[model samples]
Target: MEPPVPSKPQFSLPVDSDHKATQFRLFSLSPPHMLAFHLAWLSLFSNFFSTFSIPPLLSLIRSDLHLSSSDIGRAGIASFAGSIFSRLAMGPACDLFGPRVASATLSLLTSPVVLSVSLIQSPLSFILVRFLIGFSLANFVANQFWMSSMFSSNVVGLANGFAAGWANVGSGVTQLVMPLIYSLLTNSFQIPTSTAWRAAFVVPAVFQAVTAILVLIYGQDLPDGNYSKKSKRSSSTGSGKNFFTVLFTGLKNYRGWILGLTYGYCFGVELTMDNIVAGYFYDRFGVNLESAGALAASFGLANVASRPGGGVVSDKMGRRFGMRGRLWGLWVVQTVAGLLCVLLGRVETLWGSVVVMCCFSVFVQAASGLTFGVVPFVSKRSLGVISGMTGSGGTVGAVVTQLLLFSGSNQFSTQTSISLMGLMMIVCTLTLGLIYFPKWGGMFCGPSVEPISEEEEEDYFLLE
Candidate 1:
């Protein structure tokens, strides 16, 4: 007996008679779904803390290490390089191994490197530590895989939006709290500012380590039999290669490249905004590091609102209308916002610059929400690969933008810098629109899928 062919697994929505009542009670009381949601959100928070903590600390790192602007730029490049490589490798890995194992492993690995950031004294050492941190930052890719798997396709956009939006809150938190934490430690304990910044790294590192443990203890493994079962049928019926073969072939599709470019542009803009805005504030307004951080934090907070709002709108409008429409809208908004920043370079009045930045952040984050919302609808089986490819595009975009920003022997003035970035966003937006427009009108109606239950919805949201 060929190992007693495993009984075909029964399929049904994982709901019980008490599910509605339980879901209602959970939402009304303390739902199990809510617990899962919080855990999912916390995973993103841990990931975000690791990723965004460096931006506010950049100035302190530069000053203490006696490093040049180029050195600061290189640190970011190292991190993005790590992310790029991680996506290329881990995207398929998630498909093979499942999200739970990959996410937990990556999160656990990141903790030590995060703790080690404080120990580095030399520029090369710092870059090395950052590269290590970046390599572990593969958690984000794993998290996206988890999200796509847990939630149904209809609500995947909203789920992804909420998770990503909340994750951005980590950036906001770093901006608001890091400066205050640094100031208090420096004054009361007489800790050197560099060491205080190290504490910021240490705290998040500990949190991530703890999160890894919790995930291992409490997180459920995503179902993997779906792909395996499908692949077996395909092979026996002479339909196609195994899962890996299909995954690789998916890459050859033109649609993948178009999606990748779109992701790249959005990622480039987001990284530019998150990583460089503080420097822009400092340069343009002469705000102290603390105030500049607070301003950046404010942008992150604004994203919390705008991001989810964008997702809700996308769901209501349908994918093509929702996804493409938001892309065009974001392009226009961001272009105008970027132009305004260029025009108002180095605002003499601090408040004026703050207002402009607040407005700019709304558009920036809206674009982010819209871009990620469309990832799952492309294909359920290929979500991990597609997400990985798109994510890689975003990383490339960031690398290119960073290169452009820091390029040339001549130092760029604040006005010229802002204007150039603005121009780039415009070109990128146009390119994305031209490539996506015809496809956009057709995507929403192309297929129909099951709707996710509230419990599934919560699970999906957290996965991202």
Candidate 2:
């Protein structure tokens, strides 16, 4: 017998026609929906933790390895550069192999690279390890794709934001935890400083491996079931699009490219900040390593609320005003974030800088949440591909920003470089003005009077 329609949930949570959950239930572990949520975020969390585990210990690593400033900048660029390639490939992989298998495979493959950090001897080894480990971030494409698969359009923003936002906290958590681990090894265990720093990596490496295993065992590709059991006729996530079709269709879509560029500034800037903020505090303010790491942690920890807040607001705006509202909301919040970033760079006093940084974290991370809020709607047929493109754009942006603005050989001061990044953010945000939809309109214009195309019709069925 067909299952009865799910009752309207009490707390604004409801089930969609596809049986996907509409409201988040944080503590639930029910299979398919909630279980997938936990595994997806947790796995990504470990990836983020491992990816950023080194930054807090940079001083120790720098001293031990004798890394120069130019070497440091290049290493930072290498991490993002590695992510760019993996994230681009991850989209089609999700479309073909399903997010569960694709995400699990990538995490497992890269977890060893995380472990290899303990073996680094020179700047080249450090850079190469960082680049290889960056591939773990490809799971981000799967995380979002999985959430989009399991949640209805009305709440996909919230799902994507919460998963990614919570996962992103790993960056902050690593900033705080890595120093403690290093300190424990050196001060308590009496391990030598050089050995202690290397030993510190074992924790995140283990954490990454374990989480990948959990995801592989427990996670689901869609609300219905595992992708392997899905019939070929199923319209669920990761089923219909072929690899080349998904890749080319997503690439051909102008809207996806625009989102990619905009996301580059918002999420990309967030990544660059994660890479440098601890060192920025240590160098500029003369704070000790532990204190620098703690301060930097605030920037990443803001994702706990700020990024999810952006998603909630985007869903609300989309509900009320449709795609036009989502676009306007994204543009406005991102612009404000850019302005705050500029202010953050200009603040001189440490306390003042901390305050500004906190505020900047709110808007920038929220802008990331907002970017994904719009991503699922761009092309349902090419959802994973578009996601990969935007995700890769973020890493590309970080790499470019790091190279041009904050590089060791650059003439600009760190403060000046930060301000320049904010300015670039503002310029990139204006591009949102160009995004429009035939059914829901755009930031400044009404829907087109021209007849709806087949693509528009498909979107209407999903969105309406």
Candidate 3:
């Protein structure tokens, strides 16, 4: 018998058209693609917005609830610990059960916890609720695996970029809008400030619940490729042994660890900055809550705008150079931005600090887009595992960064402490670029780039 031939992949849009014509075609075809894009974007939005909401409200929660810095740190730890645990579960579950079920279920589950945040009175209770929210919010990873697997390799960057960019908008939106929303609702309804924050949570929670329900209704499931139903059954039944086997196999691949470490550094710096920036501003310049929240949103705005642009540029640049170049470029940009944090004192005026912070946010977000953009190209079959491991690294980094921020407790001189932390970020960037980049580049280097499977090819076309 002859060997079976693999079918050629089809793109919804032609890959080889003239630049102008391609743009025109993409614009024309965008309506349908936009539907999927927006659906995915909403998932991203829900995940990020929910993730960022608590930071802006931290001071209020601390003072009103009489919580300590360590207490707040524990809350952060609880949230990320939940995220870590959920990611571990979702990675394998996503591969086994499919993205649609995993994503919609998790997103739906998270809504109640988000709504409950405003009602928590004690630090322990708050931490516990946040942990639940984190666990249920594993939809972020599920969504990433789905979108990446659904899009074509040629434009996977763009799809991921769009989702990442828009999703980040949630954080910016939360930062920019939450304080205002809280203020307005508090004054308008004569609600207590705590009640206002709870009310603030309602908007995103409702939005997420509705979005998740819609996704469940309309979201297409990606087909299982090489893994068969029989194999899945056997693996599940033997998962105790399979778990160790997969773990050992994955660990043997140095590339995964290198990528995980690189991701960890970026994740750590980004999370640390995201969690601490409002407090950093408040401590450094005595900025009010609203102003600090707005400034923190700047990172999201910059991230959202730059991510799609990064994808387009990466597409033009080719995977190896594009991915590698962005990695190195982000390293430089992050280093400069970290150094720029030292200038927080030199800024003197609140507006000056805001401007610098916004610029800093832009670089951080661009780095985020670039880091995630490399995931699809690393390994097609193991995308879930790669994402899980690297994502976990990033989460761990975040936990570490938060711990560092919490430790720097000279309440009167937080600016100096933040500046020192910024210096550490500079070190992290340098280490990532010089030590890790070359190692990762070598491990992922190869010519046998596994083609996107037929079902995903179909999904990408439907998306377009």
Model 3 bad stretches (over 4 Å):
1-34, 223-251, 319-327, 341-349, 407-413, 430-464
Give one digit per residue, the lDDT tens place, for model 2 in 381-405. Answer: 7788899999999998999999998
Q: How accurate is candidate 2 locally (lDDT)?
A: 0.89
Off by over 4 Å in 1: 1-36, 221-243, 319-349, 407-410, 433-464
At residue 393, what lDDT does model 2 achieve? 90
lDDT of 3 by residue, 247-307 (tens): 4444454555655665555555666666777877776678899988887877667766776
Q: Highest lDDT, which number? A: 2
| Per-residue lDDT of 406 in model 3 | 54
Models ranked on lDDT: 2, 3, 1
Q: Candidate 2 vs candidate 3: which has greater TM-score?
A: 2
RMSD to the true structure for each prediction, in A, is 6.5, 3.6, 6.5
Q: For each candidate, what TM-score against the reference?
A: 0.80, 0.94, 0.79
Worst 10 residues of 2 by lDDT: 8-17
Best TM-score among the predictions, by candidate number: 2
